[model samples]
Target: MKYNMLLIIFPLVMVGCSFSTSTESLTDEIITPDIEKIEDVGSEMITHHHMYDNMDRGNHDYVDKTLVIDPNESEIFRGDVVFFINEDGEKDLSRVVALPNETIKISNSQIFINDKKLDTFYGKAHRVGLDKDSYFKMMDKEGNDYDKEVMKKVFDYNLKEKKLAENEYYVISDDWLRGNMKVLNRETVIGKVIGYTK
Candidate 1:
């Protein structure tokens, strides 16, 4: 019975001893305002927000799994990670690369906003040779399984020039070569990713 009690109490005693090692040491360790910095940066984000952007050989994969999302914060901006659903009611995620009231044009394998050519690596778009312009038109209107109007809008904007509405935001990944970048509605957004776990 004594050996069993020692076995059980050993861990407890060690824990107690460590905590009471010295009042001065405990005070010294607690003096720094590390919690304040933590609070300032907001609580630790644990939600697994969406991840993407890396692509090769006509395929893509999500890059990170530890993304943190701030659902209550809805102020969207360029480069903000936005999560939403598509016309087929499929949940998806992408970054806000262009804002509303902006003109987005893709031509010559490069993206141009408001007639100013984007000079970043993200401007280079790549995708399978698909006639996305007609992909939406081919869908049935009365009994289609996709959002015809929204899909048509996105598809048309991919090949032609488009001016985003006040409630629209353009989203795309770092692999900007794809032709199906989303010009998503503001109401479709779920939240913004603020940070990621280490």
Candidate 2:
């Protein structure tokens, strides 16, 4: 009877020792995983990340204010933020275009800088009649009269009556690669594109 008890006790002691050794090894491997989990949780607490800390610094708040801009002007500037919607309406980006008192005009699908053609590598085809004066009366190749309905209410002041006011500039889309006929005054400009963030 004593021998049987000894046999059972011996096996139990060996099994207990084995379990302790396995537990110690598991703890050693688990410590690193636990620390990694803590680090992940800490990162999640951040509200946002600073993205512009390493970017180039420059004046990015230029605005053109020569003309009366319509809210539906397809552009908007609220405080330090500017908004521009893509033609397809799929994306909207914040940016400023012109500085105050800068004159701008688009002609022949080309943008003229200070009456001289600009060699900008950016922008799209210029739309005609964006700044046509009241004297501008013509027909398209198809003989359709120049459509002036859209600008009728937007541009209440005619060019003949009032030239670009002081401290004003015109802003247009860069998509006007060739320069759209539309002109924007610095006063009417929303803002320029500085950077983008998600």
Candidate 3:
């Protein structure tokens, strides 16, 4: 009986010692955050939005699985992540390009966030007049000289059409090479993308 008791006690003591050693080792080691790893995590999380300007017609949605932003929030702090969905109900990741009362327009082959060309590397390429003029002529409904070449551009503005109120904003895809557009209002917006899948 005593031998069995000692056997059990020996194991208990050994376990206790092992736990102590593990604890000490953990305390002695320093744990640091990896910036590169964090960036990789952010990329996997779909925190940023994406738009295509060159070929794909901007209909392909890259599904993201993080963040849902509220448009009515009184104060939007920095580092807030947001997302936009493709009009075809496809999921693509996008950051909030404009806040409330901001106007997004496409004139040249670039995007103007609040009347200024936003300096961004979010698009694949720049195809001028990809489909802008055709979309304009189609939306005009007045037969305002929609050209045949313009019809080849296959994107229509896919964001929201609702008027932006005092504190509301709008966003658009970067595929408006030829003037075709899709608008995004705050209400229609999906949550801001906080992460993306690889």
User: Which candidate number maximizes TM-score?
Assistant: 1
TM-score of each: 0.52, 0.28, 0.35
Off by over 4 Å in 2: 1-103, 123-163, 177-192
Q: Is candidate 1 or candidate 3 better by TM-score?
A: 1
Rank order by TM-score, top first? Answer: 1, 3, 2
Provide the RMSD of all predictions against the true structure, rounded to 1 decimal.
Answer: 24.4, 30.3, 24.1
Assess candidate 2 and give its TM-score to the true structure. Answer: 0.28
**How many residue pairs clash in each candidate at the backbone level?**
4, 35, 31
Error of 2 at 37 (Å): 29
lDDT per residue as tens, model 3, 1-198? 999999999999998887753221101122111111123443223344334322123333232222333433434421233344556776543334455666555433444544444444322123232344545555567666655455443333223223345645444333334322344445555554333333
Model 1's alpha-carbon lDDT is 0.56
Give the winner by lDDT: 1 or 2: 1
lDDT of 2 by residue, 69-100 (tens): 12334333311122333345422222222334
Q: What's the C-alpha lDDT at position 23 in model 1? A: 29
lDDT of each: 0.56, 0.31, 0.40
Better of 2 and 3 by TM-score: 3
**TM-score of model 3 relative to the true fold?**
0.35
